[model samples]
Target: MKTQTLNVGLVGYGMAGRTFHAPLIQAAPGLELTTVVSRDAERVRADLPDVEVLSRAPALFARPDIDLVVIATPNDTHFPLAKAALGAGKHVVVDKPFSITLSEARLLKSLADEGERLLSVFHNRRWDSDFLTLEALLQAGTLGRVVALESRFDRFRPEVTDRWREHHRPGGGIWYDLGPHLLDQARALFGMPKAILLELATSREGAEVDDDFLALLEYEGLRVTLQASSLVAAPTPRFAVHGTRGSYVKYGLDPQEAWLKAGRTPAPGWGEDPLPGCLTLRDGGEPELVSREHAGLPGDYPVYYAGIAEALLHGTPPPVSVDEALEVMTLLEAGLDSYRQGRWMKLKESNGLRKRLHAH
Candidate 1:
């Protein structure tokens, strides 16, 4: 069967939309960048000259040619914009932190189901070079029965800018902004944790929202730590996975976002990680560290859009499913509750709501 190209109407021209969504949508084979909703028309034209630009999201939603609506707006606007797009009979993709609240996420999912539209979140970090490498190591049993994992997304942004993410509002904090990436990756590796303990703080001098956070997710015999801070000046390992047989420690972030910001498209050797992870093993007796060059897998951000295109054009499932995102939302909320209560928040897997949602 011949596949129909999905026309994507991207809402927002900020970092997420311009740097990530636009380029990947154009790179994906079965997707077309049809329209964009941004107040800055010149900025949109500078990057995407041929793409139609609208000042308001409603204008893009009213257009009949847009088959898919990708919401890359600020954190607070995600739920409303996605709800509107789904209501307009368009498949929707909302960037991470699916919603500020779990109730909003549940409502969006219900709306998508009622409208028979595909709803997905842009959890693109699953394709990061370091993450992919870790996944391969775990699957190969290079790391046997993983017992502990540490995921960090630290930055040295000591000065708080006047951005929406820094404001004292719902979904405005380092946790909400960067937490989804770490939390989603953890949930993907290990299913929902038994409990979560979180510590949140405003470390920066002029920070209004949380600028630092540490969350511990507890499993039966495993403990996963997810952390992010804006005051870290020194280098830290992005991922540290330890198991009974071996350990994989990777230092450095994925290079795709930097490459995209520099106006470079995904090409040959695009997602190559210059700093490879070190694998230390003790399978037999003594622990020996092995250093291999370019051991990490190549990162591919375009794959998310490619899967979205395939899902909409054909009958395939979305790259990030609604239930998967819902699980992330649940964890996000649980972390916040843990922070507020100053204790561990237990997750009940056998609850009625979770059972009805069929979340794995």
Candidate 2:
């Protein structure tokens, strides 16, 4: 008998599906780009001539050959599509913020558990060069005890486009769109915060929902700030981590997203970021601080799909596990409560969503 490759059925061939999921899924060793559900069959065929393109997600879920269903649809559509896919007995991968609500994420996790199917979220930012390098530095104590960390995902899209994300829908806006990436990275580094404070703004003219946001994750003796905006024209550091011994600041975002956007496939030296972060050390008691460039680790986005394939094929762990994604979802929803109430939402042991999930 021939070796079996996991057949992936991707829903929504828009930006997430076309740029990230489809290509990364194709690059994985034990995964096959078998089918895609999209309204524009011509567009999908132009990019993937050999793959099958269907007009509806229900059709993709109903197909017997599909082993994994990757949901790259809008945030509001994620829950329904994923639920149906799982009901059809296909393993699922949801593009983040997991879903529009924490309750939905928990329900999905329960369904996956009952069905014995793999359920993962796409937190690709965890593998960015900046994030990877920072993770290494923290593990090696290069920054000593981190006191403050700031993660930003800013862009210069001043004019709001006619897109689903920019609309006034339930999951539309920069907070829901970009917040997941920053929050996931922070949670992955520092775990859940004790409390969360959020400030949202409609910075752009004629914009319906918030286009800029700032969130503060509070921990004991440490503060993690996550920000994203559509009006940031000036240059900003992708990461600025301050610790007892030193500070590591890196300007410019990772180049991996641009590489993928430019239609570059993963290969040798694909994710090696050219810009090195500057680390200022205060190891000495003297007045002067020492500063030097710190090289970043190459990003490995392909590893996500590779890990997913391993989990499905060999019973290894998925790249972005359901529990981890649920944690981010809890924060995402809590941040909204903070923004609405104009107060920090404490996340104690009694907090229903996170606490109960952790207990489980």
Candidate 3:
């Protein structure tokens, strides 16, 4: 197989840029980490000594050698940076929450279409081990028809930090931060929800943004709850699913992020599934406990870059398509509405504005 080398220009050297994008882009086989856009030239050089660190976003976009631009900047800059990259005739990959509003996402999608560029959103949680296992079990009917699913991403950060997350601003809350992961996973498992009931609040003392939230997704013969919190010290079941035939419970997080942070890439036991989730099912006389191990697939962040390369070079569809991301954004906006209205909000109705404006 023939492969082409793709020069990548990464914007922003923040936590997301340094920790996630840089490492993954360097690890990808068909991609080259050529240039980075960051004001902190010293830090960028220290971390990525070989790659040239450009000071401004436009400088990187102007480079003829760069084939792809990865945007890991703050929520507000996503739309503008992505638009500029696409307009510069470069492929773009924006981090989660795609943009602050559904309209911004729609606009970027339209702009990408007009410019004939490949655009993708980085919803890395879709590759999470526990999520992958649950998806497989559900697909194989091992859990028989899933009746209810509950997912939780809890933490213990009581005091508001110096980061932008603790502030009360657009895309400055737990919902916009962690909600994308849970909601994206839910939408992946069960399409769009008919209605969403949200209970969002600042449970932590002196916290401006919402530190906790619980969103209930209503589906046919299925009830899904997506939750997150910065106040819960002791987290509960990571994933719990109940089905007609049986139930599966897993109590651990995926190890990819931890391993990556630890600087242990390509090592043995990477992205390994922890263990078989305890299961309860009816065999013949009564319910029995079954311990079945789920197969572990390698967590490859490089796949995102590979998809971008394929899309830009060969005109193939991206890994996370714009339509799929738009669906997630719609649910996110609906969740916000549910939080404010103090009731369930239908996604279709709440997102009608964007849909009508971006109608085919």
Q: What's the CA RMSD for each of the models?
A: 3.8, 3.9, 5.0
Give the alpha carbon lDDT tens digit for every residue of 54-124 in model 1: 99999999898888899998999999899889889988999998999999999999999999999999999
- The TM-score values for the models, in the order shown, are 0.94, 0.95, 0.92
lDDT of 2 by residue, 170-191 (tens): 9999999999999999888877
- Models sorted by TM-score, best on top: 2, 1, 3
In model 3, the runs with Cα more than 4 Å from the true position are: 1-3, 284-298, 349-360
Which candidate gets the maximum TM-score versus the true structure?
A: 2
Q: How many residue pairs in model 3 have overlapping backbones?
A: 0
What's the lDDT for residue 258 in model 1?
93
Number of the top lDDT candidate: 2
Q: Write the residue-wise lDDT of candidate 3 on 21-82 in tens digits.
A: 88888877678888999989999999889999889999988888888899998887898899
Q: Per-residue error at 86 for model 3, in Å? A: 1.6
In model 3, which residue pairs have backbone atoms overlapping below 3 Å? none
